[model samples]
Target: MRALIAAAIGLAAALAVVLTVTAIGAPPGETSPKPLRTTVPEHP
Candidate 1:
């Protein structure tokens, strides 16, 4: 039970990080299903 809870917490944290970075650092037009692995560009 403890292991399961730890795994869940880890997964949640990882998901939160991904979402935070995507929402904050990603560009404005990443709604499609192709560019899920985009990198931060140099400038606008």
Candidate 2:
């Protein structure tokens, strides 16, 4: 029982470290400006 609890704690700690590292290294979202749309005549 003690061994199982220890293993679980170790696994949780490893996962937490991995998640923290990934979150910190992730890229930022797009911030570029969009082009303006011009009105065009409709064709029949």
Candidate 3:
């Protein structure tokens, strides 16, 4: 269980680093490579 938790934390850290780098290097006039966004439906 300890090992599993460590692995999950490591993976999350690596992913965050990669995403930050990608966002910084993204070219102007282009959308983000991965849109970390969510949308909600409108109600009447």
Candidate 4:
């Protein structure tokens, strides 16, 4: 029972870390290669 409780706490902490990283965007050594296009080009 105690082991199960500890496992659950560990899982929650891992999830929290993942969520925080995702909220902060890309990590230090990586970045987006291209900027997003917000508008469509006019037809020829």
Best by lDDT: 4
Ranking by TM-score: 4, 3, 2, 1
Q: Please give the RMSD to the true structure for each candidate, in Å.
A: 10.8, 9.7, 7.6, 7.3
Please list the residue runs of candidate 3 whose C-alpha ends up more than 4 Å from where it truly belongs after superposition: 26-44
The lDDT for every candidate, in the order shown, is 0.87, 0.90, 0.89, 0.92
Candidate 4 — which residues are off by over 4 angstroms? 27-44
- What's the residue-level lDDT of 3 in candidate 1? 100
Runs of candidate 1 with Cα error greater than 4 angstroms are 27-44
The digit string of per-residue lDDT tens for model 1 on 1-44 reads 99999999999999999999988886667467766648877886
Better of 1 and 4 by lDDT: 4
How big is the positional error of residue 41 in model 2, measured in Å on the Cα after superposition? 71
Cα lDDT for residue 41, candidate 1: 75
Residues 2-24, candidate 3: write the lDDT tens digits.
99999999999999999999989
Kindly list the per-residue Cα lDDT of model 4 for residues 1-44, writing each as its tens digit: 99999999999999999999899988568567998889998899
For model 2, what is the C-alpha lDDT against the true structure? 0.90
Query: How well does candidate 2 match the true structure in TM-score terms?
Result: 0.56
Q: What's the CA error at residue 3 for candidate 2, in Å?
A: 0.4
TM-score of 4: 0.59
- Colliding pairs, model 4: none
